[model samples]
Target: MSAVESSARRLPLVLRNPSFGRVWAGQLLTQAASRMFQVGAVWWLVGFAGGSHRGLDSGLFLMVSTLPAVGLAPVVARVVARHAHRTVLAGAAAAAGAVAAAAALLARAEALPMAAIYAVGLALAACQALFDPCLTTSVPELVEDADIESATGFELSTQSVAGLGGGLLGPLAVDAGGLPGVVAACAVAYLLAALLVRSARFPHATARTGGGSPSDTAPASRTLRQVLAGLPFIRRVLVCFAAANVFTTAVYVVMPLYTRGVLHSTGSTVASLEAALGVGTLVGSFTGARVPGRPVAVGSVCLIVMAAALGLPGLAAGHAVALGALCVVGWCVGVIGVRFVALFQRLVPADDKPQFFAVMQALLGATFPVASLVFGALGDHLSARTLCLVQGVGLVPVALALRWAGGRTDAEELPGSATQSPARAREAS
Candidate 1:
């Protein structure tokens, strides 16, 4: 009874802390807005623009939109290191809102060109490139050191929930509001997110370390050399991340095609399968927060499970089994995401996190688009079943590569004779 009562009392304490609660809310709103806007954009493209509603193709548009952000990430990261975090974040939010507004207008005109849509995606991505580093680094300021891990868990959970909830809401909103309505709703979410950041209970900008200003007034000078130093760790993580993305992207390219072409499933069933993944992600996020061992090991398991889930459609004797497999895959992806963030936090320092994260996002921009392009082209020649089999089999090599990358120790180590955190040391050896 004492343990149960004690646990009950502690849960509220975790939630009630003002700083954690505020940041948690901010993350939730940001993710919610992202998912809704993303889904709505795809729906608009397919329904209004006569494009495919599939994620891989739609993801191309989204990825192209984000390219500028990826291109400017290193520079923006340096700027973030010199300026007030709040100032940059507020500006980023405003810019993102503007992009969303542009998207809304284009959809309303019903004359949205692929080029025009891609342009909006670029603007939105750039704004996010600036905003993300500020937010990730803000965690230390919001809570004491002891609370950082819990805060990470809280942030991950909120993001997962927001994504799942907003994804569910997006189609419903689209039915009621049309393409224009969907964009408007997303714009509102961003605007509200901006306001929330401005009023949130974070520490003063002066207290923060990263996200420096462009004017170069601050003492934390992160030069190209300093930034370059993070490459080894970055290289290690990217191997895993990129491989996983390629495999996943290849599989997703065929899901709808397989659903309709092979299984003869209804459109609604495909939608349900997609939504089930989102729900799985939400569940996985909460569960990932409790993982006891190393993050990479945990992430690896999650990734492999996701890969298997992706392949299940090929092996499942029927439609119902396929749906179940997809849901499991989705849950694993949610779990992988939380570990991904924690891994990022471990590899980079407080000041350079944005820059490093930007590198990752940039790779995402560059790689996924190319991967999608290849997969789309490949689909013309390959059977969906054959593609799934290849991707599933390919997962083994990719996983091995990632594991090897993570385990590889450079001849040189971090400067200052760093005592690696338990997490870092695990893979380093």
Candidate 2:
């Protein structure tokens, strides 16, 4: 009972750390604000336009929001790497708050043009490029190495909560608050995120060190090397992802077809599995965060199990069985995600962490969609179950390869490091 109680309290205890809590709260507010803004903006555009141009407006809005983040990623990476993580994040959030306030004012005055809306959306995406890496890189600074993995799990789970909430609450917010009210809410949220982050006390940021201070603002540059600092790390990560993503992409493409063709079910039935998957992921994240062990081994095992779970729906089983499989898959993914991110943080140098994250993001953005399209095309003639089976069975070797490489990487990283954490050493052995 005492052991169980301690495990239960780990999350709450971690959350109570003033420094980590501040950053965590800021992340929660910012992500919720982001989801609220994205959904509300899209809905507003479709409602107000109410014509053939609506489709074009919607498409352009997505492209504008997505492309700017990827395009401006290198710049954000440089700023996060060289200058100061805290400053970059807080400044970007504050700037976003200003943009949100301006949009709210314009909406209230009935003078907000579609073009202006696109511009604001693009600006907000750019802010995200700054926020994500700054937060990831600064995690090690906020807590001891022992707590980093758990800290990461809690951080990511916040996004999942916001994603689920944003979908449910976005419509309600717009209905109750109006366009102006929604935007105003975003502005307040962004401002609060900024304030929370700005007040957090980070030791590295204020340390008396040879580098002057971690918070010492250096001018960010757009140099070739700085732009490409994380290329090697990106390559390594993508190699692993490439093997795993085929299975994931297959699941997404196959889910719909399996529901209709195999289960003779409706879209609502499919949604139930997806929802279960998400809830399972949230539950898994908490567990993943608390577990202290070899990340690579843990992540690889989860991936293997998740890959196997993807094929369960293909079985001529009932809907409940399929949903159970998906839940397991989601839980596995949640665990894998936490470990993968922790490994990446441990692998990359602090100054290069943001660049590595940016490259990883860009590669993921481009890769997964194309893989889905390819898989969707395959599903035209192939049975979804067959596809799932093949990929699930095939990806196990890839997971093993990742486990091997992870061990090697840990061994290589520790020898050069000034401080070696036990997790790294254990994995290396």
Candidate that would win on TM-score: 1
Model 2 has an lDDT value of 0.68
Q: Candidate 1 — which residues are off by over 4 angstroms?
A: 1-23, 46-48, 51-59, 66-69, 141-149, 201-203, 207-241, 250-271, 282-305, 315-319, 334-366, 379-387, 400-429
> Which digits, one per residue and each the tens of the lDDT, describe model 2 over residues 227-297?
44433433454677776865674554456556655776644554565566668878787677776667766
TM-score of 1: 0.71
Candidate 2 Cα outliers beyond 4 Å, as residue runs: 1-16, 46-48, 53-56, 144-147, 212-277, 283-358, 367-429
lDDT of 1 by residue, 1-429 (tens): 698766754774346566556555656666676666655555545344543434445557645644655577568867777676666776777767877887888788786666776676666667766776667767777766766787766764565578666666665566578767867887887777777777766664445554655458835647535865655755666766786777675544455456555676543444565577777766776687787666656766676776677676666646776677767877777677777676666555677765556556667656666655566556556666666666677676666665666566552554322655554556433
Instruction: Please provide the root mean square deviation of candidate 1 (C-alpha atoms, Å).
Output: 5.9
lDDT for 158 in candidate 2 is: 81
Tell how far residue 429 is off in model 1, in angstroms. 7.9
Query: How much lDDT does candidate 1 score?
Result: 0.64
RMSD of each: 5.9, 8.2
Lowest-scoring 10 consecutive residues by lDDT in candidate 2?
227-236
